[model samples]
Target chain A: MQNLNKPNFKFTPLQIVQISVTVFVILLGLNLWTFYAEPLSKVLSPYWNDNLIDILVLIPAVGAAVAGTLLTRQFEKGETPYHIWQAFTIGLWFWVAGEIGGMVNDALYWDTIYPDFSLVDMFWLLGYFFLGLSLYYQLRLVYGAKSRSRRRIYLGLVAIALLVSAGLTHLAIKAGLGEGYAWIILFVTVLYPVFDLTEGATAIWISFLFGRGQWSRPWWGLILFALADSVNTFYWLGGYGFIPVAAQTVLNFISVIAYPASYMVAGLALLSNYFILRYGENSGLLKVAIKSEINKP
Target chain B: MKYFFRQIEDIPLDHSPVSAEVYFRGENATGLIEKQFNADRVAALLFISGTPGMAYLIEASQSKSISLAEFSSFADGVSHTRAINLPDVAGRLMLLALESKVNDKFTITTEEAWDKKISRWKQEQRSGLVEVKSKNLHGFIFFWQGELQKLDLIFSTPQGFVSGFPKLNALDDSAWDVTTYVHSASAQAYQCTVLRQGAMYWCHKILVRYQEMVGQKLLKMMDRELNRQMQPWHWNINLNENDMLDTHFFPYLMDEAHAYRALFMAMGAQMNFVIGNNLTQRLLSETFEQIRPDERAALQSQRLIPAAFSE
Candidate 1:
């Protein structure tokens, strides 16, 4: 992660435009993956099983995600608009993390004789998890403002998020105790929303603090939130695919309804803050600020 | 004229001109208006712009046969013909400051013949001797002697030389040529380049204009207005002082929505101009120039730009 306090760094229109193109490419890749997953799997699986292929795909995906994360950091460092290597790596990691998470779930639940718990598979998941963790922490390091209070606030937030996510996962798994662990399913269900909200908030805070004139964090946070919610909306609208209509509607209510509403709430909070700054100075304070500025060389 | 005054009772129509005066009491309202008019009469317009307590003079005239136009040639310059008049008193005053260097007579054509009429009428045959008359005016006309090389609005109102030519050309109200008209309208051309460099530049030319007009009156008014409209959000500002530092805004999302809503509400009563998308997009695009790309995409996808701000 790059330090944000460099005087020479500035976000350019071209950079924003390039970043947008990269985002578009990522979205396109995801769409293609969703549409051709099975057909692509059939062709590739001739040499490997479906599960192995899934893990194999993670190699490039996780790499892309890491690279993309690094690219973001580099951009902040005023290196260039984007580094192709970084973008590709970050993109790769994003895909790998999801795949690895799923594979871990499969290994835990569906394996017979405990599947002897393949070291390679386990290592891969752990690797991807750490990669994601690193990316997140690096993001904070590069973009987060350096203030003691802010650091404390962010740390507190992360702690709360992890605790809440873990607790919810525990409850879900406990409910299905005797029927089998099913911990992965519980973890995912609990993980998505908690991380989404936290990531969104963190993104905004980082942009406010370090981006200064850049839009990287805010754009990503908003687009990601919008995309995530949109997926739920589309899925629900498609009759929840295989899920029961009632359950699907409930999921839709939380993701489609509550998620967007929360973003709006956050946006409103920022606006209120701006209003206060623009309008809440006392006469004496205002005079002092003006006089002080005038008194400056 | 009587008919025009009657229309004043219903002034500021969404589509056509409304006959009433508009008042801008909010802190930034004057600033906003000054940016638009570049004149000292923002407060003057405030007496006319709609308010809860202010009765629509046109509305009052509506029941009768009186019109606002009757007063334009006779009373104050509040009539329709003058409503559209360029080089108005305030505008002319600023023009004097610029014209102080002008000595020779040159042809000055306006896009609108009316502007030409007003300009010619106000032309000083002798330096400092331009006798512009009408029962509606209340100031002495001063002309700076020099060759009329250019139109300058910096010292004048927006209607003065800055917009004088453009207003005339825009009589057809078709395309507004920035080069031939007002140069200040294109102030955001470099903003895109600035953003590309990761730097943000905020130009508050209008805010500066407002500060010059009524001291801190508008700022104080805005604070009070916020208090009234948005309770629970006690904006801590001393509204009694004439200091810019005392000015602040509690820019919450709701406030953004409200500000937009108020702007639209006012604009909607005027005319629906196709700004593409929705009213919000139109307003932001026109005022801010650079719209957040995501926001633009979102609105375009949603078809949300209102057609009022284009006008």
Candidate 2:
């Protein structure tokens, strides 16, 4: 509860980067170790815990939640930009709640991976509502100012995304993952990738428009989040082994490594934004204020 | 910040008996009035007879009561409740003399009538000041508490400036233009006082506070952006490194409130571009907080600036 406006009050940008990278590595290693360790030795067996990864996601997710609160509090609440960011923060909190729900699921039923549908999925899916709102608001703000070429470029990029997602889905269906699955289950599972792709594409466009501007970095986190979620969508559809038997060993050896890491990275991005706006190195207001003070006659 | 001053409420009053040095500033009589009052269109007069010794004289206007709503345009420069004490008789005579319509030749001889009226006004127990203007003399006759009190004079001779009451024989009155201001001896007394200056002080404070709270370095580095934003205003003023306006706002004497508001808003919009709206607004509020509470109160009362001047 140090004063928020004081110069250099919190973590530096380097420290934020270090924390994100460290958390990502730990999440990835633990997730990979769970799948890879059992084949190697009993020594690693005692150390690996599948449920721990579910709980560990809260570390970054909660950090993201705190960053959101600061963002909403520090910025002018009535502004359109802040409203958009507030929507994004709400989406992030929904994801955090989903992670917490997953932890509860793991604690309650040690054997089950997840029920066909559960409250956790509901939380994660609801997060898309807020993410969609934020993306829509941002688009509306920049929509009027965009040139014809820029709009065409956005549409072309989106079309390209659609083709890539279609190809990935085709690969899963060709491997028979979609063959006997219930239509409802397939539809629900497909929704995650759809939302992720839309969010990622819109974020890319926003970043492009704001180049070297204030909003440039905030959307980058959502892009990372979308990528990780896309990979998880395949895992959920049981498409891992569809590539080939030659790659089956590595395929089966991957145990949800990217999912938590993605969440951590997203959280790290939000934290970094909050820190940079108020106190992070090279960009914080306090440092600039001090510099101005020094330069004065 | 959401403040505006449609009408100037306070005329910076020099209540003390002004010294000859401070009032005339050693300038020759021909240019003294123009230098002091013409820029802001504010005319101030001081009389030495009364205890509360300020005779505020607003130059005569066609519309004695103009709406403060038109204060933004400041079409005629002087429009405020304080101006409700319209020039009347005394105000007109001062204005006519200051207008230099009569340098030395005039046959409107009120000399005999001037002494007679003073005696009559004393008998009637009327309290006010009489204004006498001539080619070389700007004379004031003070009446305090229904009594003839003092003679204060400023001699605007080509020989140079001389001040203070002249001896009885020293006054030669073949022809004179004389008028009287009947003091109401009530609360509605600040009518003729014009308030056309002091905007520079507020503008300076805005810059200094912004420098201290948010960092003027950001504004200093934005030359291209400032020029781009200010292109519409077409102003050629002295804006310093901190984006502080230095004394070039005199042209806005009639509408200083709106003029400075435009400057304030432009700088604020630039800050938003740099840091974003939240911190920009927060910093703006902090900068506005630098103004003293009383000054802010006065400004706000006239809608010159917002309650806290927050964005």
Candidate 3:
């Protein structure tokens, strides 16, 4: 008899993709129905408030957090590297913070002139900081001590890019909001997009370094996330008609898809990453398939 | 003709069976000899050990069924009880006696000298007739004095026997002794050694160099087998002190079923356990009892051994 105490909970790459895509589609469908579908919107009009959207977004964020925690436990049990779990945990925590902050705004119905630069915005900034920190740690794992100079150069390049983007965002925010806006509101608004752009850039860079052959799934997911975040920045700017009329018209269309797509893509990336760590070709969880394409030289 | 000799009781007087019925001795028993006897019609002898004056009975029985007194006379004539010096030698004598008892048409000349017989046996080994059967890593069994003996498990590879535990060089001469050759593959012999701590069999140890070399080889093989670009050694170098001591080092031992599974995967082989003989199955159960609770639990968690192997 096989031992009941020891359970082999392993999944294949195709299975992982299938499960993740299904979850993503269901969540995206629900979000679309809540916003755009009139019949369902009327049915959920009372129950599906902004607070419900907050919980809906929180589901994936919290699920990623839980998956990270489980992966950490598995690392301890199986002696796998802890850095993979740590990266997801840190990134998921940031998402949780951003979601919680949004949930609070919807729950309390805060009415301030510059809602963009409220206490909730501070949490969002802190969330992005942790997400960036997680990526930095991940980069360190990829490039060990031998490439000290190269890592330094990479970090320097990221800093320069972040600064240039931040400067551009600051100028755009000033032009969009007008001189009547407080300096603090302008600074916070500019910082938000800058954090998102930095995270997107970092994800792309990491994907470029390690993503090849069979490892392309997570890379594709990261690229989608980066694109979604880039589109989201324009959506945020276009909300107040700060963007030019021509760009605003494009932003309005992009915003419809990009906002929900960002969370879904990020969730998919985290799930795919978890599978890679837990059941990758090298993980010994699957039967040895010498003839498989992944095993080809 | 070269013969592989082992002791067996209750040989059928009516039937002339070609194969040998040798009882499982220990890990050191010649697996190649057993396989040859089973596969080909290689000659084999089975006899009881510790019987008094049995050598004389064997020698005289070549011509006729000699009386017990004549057997005693033949034994008394000899200056030494040659059979006592090496009880295994009696197996050769028993074969000669059996040939006489059967009154076979062909006359077989038995080598009288003990050293000559041993030399002949060694010569027979190189003839390519002997085939070594591959054993599952966990199938090692040892028996002494009709009782199951606890043994230190060793992994048999083409190079040599890989000891599962580290040996301390400070041990005295009496503490260490090579027990027997266990299993072999592709004409390569894998030997098993017993380490004694006073009266108790403690732990098994292999050559430190062989251990390290095999570990390195397995790592490289695993990388190739999995088609992994990043090697474990590269990651292992950067591992923190805690991970190095606990997680990574255990698999290097390779005696544990979990470690064996990893090594076999590298070799592109799947590991499965066979229960072997009934005595060994019981002894293995007892050996499992000797293991620490946590260690036993860890082995159980790997689930490498099939339920049939345990039975």
Model 2 compared with the native: what TM-score?
Answer: 0.44
lDDT of 3 at B24: 18
lDDT of 3 at A225: 51
Prediction 1 TM-score vs. true: 0.28
Q: Write the per-residue lDDT of candidate 1 for residues B22-102, one digit (tens) a residue.
A: 322321121111101122211112121122111112232121122234322233433222222222223323222222222
What are the runs in model 3 whose C-alpha is more than 4 Å off? A1-21, A38-52, A77-81, A110-116, A169-184, A212-222, A236-262, A265-297, B1-311
Interface RMSD of 2: 11.4
Per-residue lDDT tens digits for candidate 3, residues B1-311, read 11222212122222222121132122212221111222222222222322221212232213233443444344222322111011221222222222222311221122233235335546643211111113211112222222222222232322333334212221111122111222221111111011011012101111111112112222222334333421432211111111111111111112333333333233222110110123223333434455444334444544532232322
What tens digits encode model 1's per-residue C-alpha lDDT throughout A1-297? 112222233543234334534544454454344434545556764223445545434443443354345334433233222332233244334445546666766656554443323443444334334433433553433322344675676678778987998897786566664245456545544555566566556555534433322113222333345445555635733546777888865664455333333223322222222222223332111221222121111
Q: Write the per-residue lDDT of candidate 2 for residues B1-311, one digit (tens) a residue.
A: 00011121222334221332243333211111111233234434322111112233334311122222322233243332221111122322233233222222223455455567657767886544455555445444445445653222233322333444433334453555555553321222211111111233455554554443323333343433444444454343345654443322121223435544555555555444444555455445544566655445544544555322323
From the highest TM-score down, the ranking of the candidates is: 3, 2, 1
Answer with 2 or 3, whichever has the higher TM-score.
3
Looking at candidate 3, what is the lDDT of residue A169? 55
Which parts of model 1 have CA positions greater than 4 angstroms off? A1-147, A177-193, A204-297, B1-311
Native-to-model Cα distance after best TM-score fit, residue A130 in candidate 2, in Å: 1.5
List of chain B TM-scores, one per candidate: 0.19, 0.34, 0.17
- DockQ (Cα-based) for each candidate: 0.03, 0.04, 0.04
Instruction: Give the Cα error of residue A18 in candidate 3, in Å.
Output: 5.1
Q: What is the C-alpha local distance difference test score of candidate 3? A: 0.39
Report iRMS values in order.
19.8, 11.4, 18.6
